[model samples]
Target: MKIMNILQIHNLKPQFPCTFRTFPHHSLSGSLNFSLRKSTRLSSSSFLLLLVTPIRPTFKIFTVSRIEAPFFENNKEEEEEDEERNSATNLTEFEDLAPDGVVYQNTLRLVECSMFAAVTGLVYFLSNSLSIENYFGCFFSLPIVISSLRWGVAGGRKTMVATAMLLFVLSGPVKALTYLLTHGLVGFTMGSLWRMGANWGLSIFLCTIARATGAVGYVLTSSFLIRENILALITINIHASLTFIFAAAGINTVPSMNFIYSLFGILVVLNSGFFVFLLHLLYSVFLTRLGMKDSLRLPRWLEKAL
Candidate 1:
């Protein structure tokens, strides 16, 4: 039995020589020579058998840990879209949404209007209480200008009416009428021109003309009330001043009253122009302090001079 087992093992070893050839030798040249010799020794039947045999694929086994995340999602595009939607929704959630009609409902604007009316009334009161000259009454128009600038020509008219009513109650109809003839007319004329987007020069020119007309009307009204010609009085004063000047200069000629009157008219016009410029300076300063932008900016040289 032992001799038969040995004989079988020896025959089996020669039958599968390609099984040893499957592993490469240490030397590449030796391995190549062995492969060539093995191929030459193999019969056509053995080569056919080797070709028909199936190869078994080998795999390596490894230990890998599986980690789990609670909020992680598998759809990458959906995750990106969700992030974008969350950001956009957060941005639009707390926007301010105010109504358009709220402009008329502002109590602060009403308060500002009342304050302007009171200021104008106070100026009237001072003019009356102090018995200041009628020319000093020009200062009363400042509040009206401010009101007009703040709220437009309509607001200015309201301020004028309010001021007149206040003055009427305090100093009677005569004082109120005087104010209307002087400051009130100038205020309304300037405010209307300004509100209509007129240039500073044109607006000032119109205001000066309106004021001059008001002065003429006031003079006529005063003359009618006092039974005296105010223009004749003014002409007399001008004639006296010219006679004094000419006497000092050693001139014998006495100019005609018409010449004196014409000179007085020219001086009045020039004075009105000066007043317009003065009012413009006041307007610029007040508008700047009130944080309002002026439609007509002061020239650089004028601003520096002021």
Candidate 2:
């Protein structure tokens, strides 16, 4: 019985030890699992937060001390001084023109005006003095065209006025009026058209129209006033001149006043075209020689030839 009891006691002791060992083992495992789960949850939450929130760089704000303010003030003053110097040196184109330069340009304009006026007066006198055809009167355009190209419409008008005054002084009012209507009007028309930068074709067309209108009016008025065959004589003379030229070219053709009158419109266009072409050539030469800028443009074909 004692041996049995001892065996029983030993078995109970071993059971208690085993129970204690199992309980401790299970508790340690549970604690380890709980800690691992907590760590996993914390790591996932931290990763999600990092993904959701964007990280931005921090900038430092600096305040200038009172001691550095004077230095900055000096720098600003220096910058302003440099700006003033640049402004003083870099002037606008018009402002950069010196007083002497202004005076010189004005003087040159006056000289040109005087010269052109004289030329116009001389041409007028020559046209009136000569008993030949009215072709000599066309020379009056020289000054008007030059003035227009050099100084624009205002200059042309001034020149026209000066020429008219000179004509009035040189010849009687009647002669002056005649010259103004017949020649001066054409010059003014051309100059105005040129000053406006009209295209070559349009300029020629307008000038031709003006010339034709003026010529017809002058002829009809003069015929009515004089009670003579002035138109017939003028047409006959023109026909004779053309016939002579055609004969010289080995084409003998006698032209009549009726035929000439019938073709007067066509003749005017051709004649104006020829005269304007010549005037353009003169203008090109004059502008180039004088180193003046002109906006006048000729036809592409005419440009090539000129």
lDDT of 2 by residue, 1-306 (tens): 675588577774222111111112233223321112222222333445656886443344457767544445877888999998888766643453654466556767777887898887877787668864366654667687778777778787788778888888888666666666666667787878877778877777777776666667777778877898787887887898889998999986787777888777677667766765676566666655676544565567655664
- TM-score, candidate 1, is 0.59
Q: Each candidate's lDDT (Cα)?
A: 0.72, 0.68
Query: Candidate 1 vs. truth: CA RMSD?
Result: 14.4
Residue range 1-306, candidate 1, lDDT tens digits: 564477577764234444313533445243321332343355445655667986443334456878876575768768899999998866544322222234443444466667776777776778678877565655677777777766777788888888788878887887788889878888887767766777778877888887787778888889988999998998998899999999999999898988997898788778777887787777777666677656445567666765
Q: What is the lDDT of candidate 2?
A: 0.68
In model 1, which regions exceed 4 Å deviation?
Answer: 1-114, 132-139, 294-297, 300-306
Local error of candidate 1 at residue 194 (angstroms): 2.5
Quickly count the clashes in candidate 1: 0
| Positional deviation of residue 220's Cα in model 2 after best superposition, in angstroms | 2.8
Q: lDDT of candidate 1 vs native?
A: 0.72
